[model samples]
Target: MTFAPLDPVRLTADLIRCPSVTPAEGGALVLLQSVLKGAGFDCQRVDRNGIPNLFARWGEKGAAKTFGFNGHTDVVPVGDAAAWTHDPFGAEIVDGWLWGRGATDMKSGVAAFVAAAVDFVTQTPPDGAVILTITGDEEGAGRDGTRAILDWMEAQGEAMSVCLVGEPTCPDTLGDMMKIGRRGSMTGYFTAEGVQGHSAYPHRAKNPLHALVALLDRLTEWPLDGGTAHFDASTLQITTIDCGNPANNVIPARASATVNIRFNDAHTGNSLSDWLATHAEAVETETGVKIGLRCEISGESFVTPPGDFVALVADAVQAETGRRPDLSTSGGTSDARFVKNHCPVVEFGLVGRTMHQVDERVELAQIAALKAVYGRILARYFA
Candidate 1:
C-alpha cells in the first residue's frame, strides 16, 4: 500500500481536533498508532490506571544507537471554552495558524515528531531504532504514565541512548531555545495546633495563628540559594493558609499553611523536607504548640549536560532554522523528568506563548519547521 508522507500542519490540525484533555484519550493515541503502523512501525498500546499510552519503534533490531521522541497526547483542561474565538477543539486554521487547546502546549509537538518520523522512515530507515513514547497522564497526577513505561522498558531490556521531549520550549521562535534540565518541585503543608479559648482571655489559650504567621515569615525570608550555573535560584511561595474559624472572639484551634518550592540541583526533596521538619520543631519550642508538617515531592531537578546528544540537536536546529539554539533549564516540570532516569533527555518545540491560555494556538509554518529539525536530529543521531 502506498502511503502519503504526513504533513506536519495537517497532522497538527488533526491532533488538535481531539479534545484529549488530561486523563482522556479522545482517540488521539489511536490516530497516532494508525499512522505509525502504516509506516511499518511495531506499535504497542499500554494502559496504566486507565490512562492510554503508546510505544512504537522501527528500523533494524539490535541497532546500537536509538533515537527517541517523547511527548504527551494529553492537554490541560480548556477553562471556560466559551472564551475561545473558535471551539477549543475545532482545530481551526485561520491566517496561517492552527487555533485550539494543545495546539502549542503540546499536541502540535507530537504531530511534528510524527511527521518527522514519517519523513525519516520513508527517505531512509534508521540503522538503529526510532521510537516514540506518548503518554496521557502528563497533565494530571503523572502517577501512571511515563514512569510506568520506563519500568516496563527496563523489564524488557529496551534502552534508548538519547531522548528528546517535544514540550513547547521555545519562548519566541521555533528554534530559539532548547531545555537541558528542569528544576525540582516540592510542596509542604504545616499545621500548628493550639488550645481554643475566648480571644479576651489572651493568657488562657495559645494562638496557633500567631505561630503560623511567624513560621511562614521565616520560611520565605531567606533565599534557598543563589542558583547554579544552568538554573535559577530556588524559590518558596506560600500558596494557602487556612483557619476556618470566622468568630471574632474565639481563638482558632489550629492554623495550616501550604507552600510550594521550585529548587535547583543544590537541594533534594529529602534535604528540604529535613529543613522543614527542623523549622517546625523550632516553632513548636518557641510557641509551646504542636506543629505538624507534611511534604510531597513532584519531581527532582535534572540537567542533561552538554554532550553528543545535545550537540546533535543543536546542530540540527542551526541547520534548519539558521539560529543557534540557546540551551536552557527554565520551565515547569514535564514528563522529561521521568525519562531522564533512563536516558539523557532534552526539550525543544514550538513557541509557548499561548499554552494553557484561552485561544491556544501555533503557527502553521512552525509546525513544518519543527518537523524538519526533528528529522535532522534523527538522521544525525542514527547515522
Candidate 2:
C-alpha cells in the first residue's frame, strides 16, 4: 500500500496562521499533535510552568538507535505590524515566497521535518525509531520548553541516539552552512557603590561611574583567548552602564552595568564568573568603591566533532543542494544547548536572513527542498 505524501508548505501555512507567539499554545501544537497522532506516532504534551511542548515518537519507547528532530513552534512577536508587507500571521504566498513572522525563524523548519518524518515512516518504516520534540518556549524564557520535554523523556526512559536541531543555520543560501556547535552565552550584572557628594569637591566623593568605567575597561580590553579550533575567541561586551546621576555637580551613590559574554569551550561559567569577580575586586580596592558582581550563564559551549554522523548530514545536504555546507559553530544559543546533554546534536535548516525581522518570510521552493534534505537524512540514517 502506498501512503500519501505530506506537504510541508501547507503545514507551514497552517502553523503561521495560528499566532503561536511565545508562552501561548495558539493551536500550533494542537495542529501538530493531531497530525502526528493520526499518522500513528505517540504524541504527548510535556508542558511545564504553563509553557507548551509536544513529544512524538513513531517507534518503540527505547529503541537502541533512535533519530530525533527538535524545533520550536513559538515565534517572536511581530513588532510594528504596520511595517509588514503581509499580515504577520496571514501566511500569504507572493512571488513564490511565503511571508509571515515564523516563516523562516522556524515554523517552516518544524513543518518540513514533521512532514519528512511522517512520510519516511509510513512509506518505508525504519527499523529503529523517529522522535520529534517541538517546544513553544524557545522565543521566550526557555526554561519550560525543550528542557521540560527532555525531563519527561528521562522519567519515561525514552531516548534518542542522535538528534538534529532544525534551526535556521544557513546564512546566504539554503545549503550554505550547518552548525555543529554553538558558543556559550552569559551576562554579568555589576554594581558599584560610593559616597554621594558634590562633584566639584572631587576628593570628598567616590565617583561610582569612574569605578564602573575602569572595571568595564579592564574587562573589554583584556582578550578572553585567541580562538578555538572549532569555535571563535571569547568576547565580553558592555551592554549598559547607568549612574542615575542627573546633576553634573553631584556624584551618584551607585552605578550599575551589564556585561554579556559569548565564550568558547575553553572556559566554564564558574571560571568566567571568577574572572569578573577578580576584576571587580581589584577596581573596588584601587578606587575604594564597593563593587558587587553577579553572573548568569545561559548555556555552555558544545561541539559534535567531524565524524560519520557529521559526514552523513553534509553529504545529504550537498547531494540535494549541490552546495557542500560549511561546518560552523557560529550563532547565538539554541535549545540544542539542552539536547547536547542527552545526545549528539547538530543543526541545519533554510536561510535565516529574516528570522526576527519586521517582515519575516521564506522562499516557497525552499520549503520543498528543505523537506527533501531532511528526507534524505532520514533515509541514510536509518539505512
Candidate 3:
C-alpha cells in the first residue's frame, strides 16, 4: 500500500528510517523515487560501476532554465550503536528534535528540499525545470556518485542554472552561515629506503629514519599559502609515521609517513604533488637515500563568487529570517564540488551540531524554517 505523503518532519524521519549507510541503497533511493514519481517527476535511476544514483526532473519540455537540488543518500556508519540514547535508525522525536543518523549531516536537508519540491509542484508547476541529482556513494570513495552523474548530465547536454547542496552548512543557527566555497584536500604517503644495519654500527649503513624526519620537517616548515580572501590559509599535517621495527639494536630498512594538505584555490592536486616530489627528491639527493612519494586528491578547492544566484539566495534568507547571513568558505569537501562544474552551487542547511553523532538530530521548528528558506529561494529563482 502506498503511504500518505509526508511533511518535512515525517519525510526526514522516513529517510532516516532507511539506514542508507555509505555505498548502500538501504531503500532510500527507492523511497525518493516513489515520492518524485508520484509528484509527476520523470525519474531515472542511474547506475555507474554498480553504484545507485537517481536523477529526476519535472517541467514543460524545452524549458530554458533548470534549478537543481543535489544531495547524497549515504550516511556515515553509526559507530557503536549501543552508545546512542535511541536507535540510530529509529528516527525518534523527543524534546522537539527528530533524532537519527543523517538527521543533520543531510537527510533533514534532503527532506526539506523534497518537501519544498512538493510544495513547488503543487502551487505552481515550473515554467522551467526542477531536477534532483541524488547519489548513494557520497560517504565512500565518491568515484561513482555525483562525479559520474555529472558526466552523464554533460553528455545529455543538460545544463543547470543553479544547484543547491544541502550539506548542513549552518554553524550556529539555521540560515546563519552559507558555504560559498571549499578547500581542496590531498593525501601524500612518503617512503624512505635505506640499508638495514645495527643501530650501534652507525658508520656502516644508511639511516632512512633521519631522512624521513628531515623530509617531513621541510614539508611542514612553511605554510602552503597565505589566507585567501574567501578561504583560510592552507595547511599541511603529518597524520602518521611508521617504521614498524621492534628490534632495539637494528635500524629499520625503510620508514614511511602520511601527510594531508588542506589547500586553497592557489593549489591543485597535481601542483601540490609536484611540489612534494621536488622536495622529496631534494632530500633524496642530499641524504643519498631513495624516497618515494604518492599522492591522491579528494577534491579541488572552489569558490562561488558573488553572483546573481548567490545574491538571490542571500536575499531570500534575509527576507525570510530577518537576519543577514554570512557568506562563508569554511568546510570540508562536499558534492557541491562536482555540481560546481555544471552550474553555480551553494550549500545552506540545518545546524550541524549533532551530525554523525550518536544522537544526531534536528529541531522540528528548524526543519520548517529550512523549508521556508528553500521555498523562498525557489520563489525568487523562478521569479
Winner by lDDT between candidate 3 and candidate 2: 2
Model 1 has an lDDT value of 0.89
Q: Tell me each candidate's TM-score.
A: 0.98, 0.99, 0.97
Q: How close to the true structure is residue 60 of candidate 3, measured as C-alpha lDDT?
A: 53
Which ten-residue region of model 1 has the weakest summed lDDT?
59-68
lDDT of 2 by residue, 1-383 (tens): 57699999999999999999998999999999999998999999999999999999999888887999999999999999999999999999999999998999899999999999999999999999999999999999899999999999999999999999999999999999999999999999999999999978989989999999999999988699988999989988889999877888898999999999999999988899999999999999999999999899999999999998899999999999999999999989999999999999999999999999988999989999999999999999989
lDDT of 1 by residue, 1-383 (tens): 55577898888888888879989999899999999998988888878879888988887544688888899989999899888998999999999989999999898899999999987887787678888889988999998898877777787777777899999988888789999999999999999999999999979999999998989888888899999988999999999999999899999999899999999999999999999989889988999988999999999999999988898899999999999999998878999999999989999998999999999988898998899999889888777
Best by TM-score: 2
Considering only N, C-alpha and C atoms within 3 Å, which residue pairs clash in candidate 1? none
| CA displacement after TM-score superposition, residue 271 of candidate 1 (Å) | 0.4
How well does candidate 2 score on lDDT at residue 11?
A: 97
Worst 10 residues of 3 by lDDT: 1-10
Model 1, runs deviating above 4 Å: 1-3
Each model's lDDT comes to 0.89, 0.95, 0.88
Task: List residue ranges in candidate 3 displaced over 4 A.
Answer: 1-6
Write down the TM-score for model 1.
Answer: 0.98
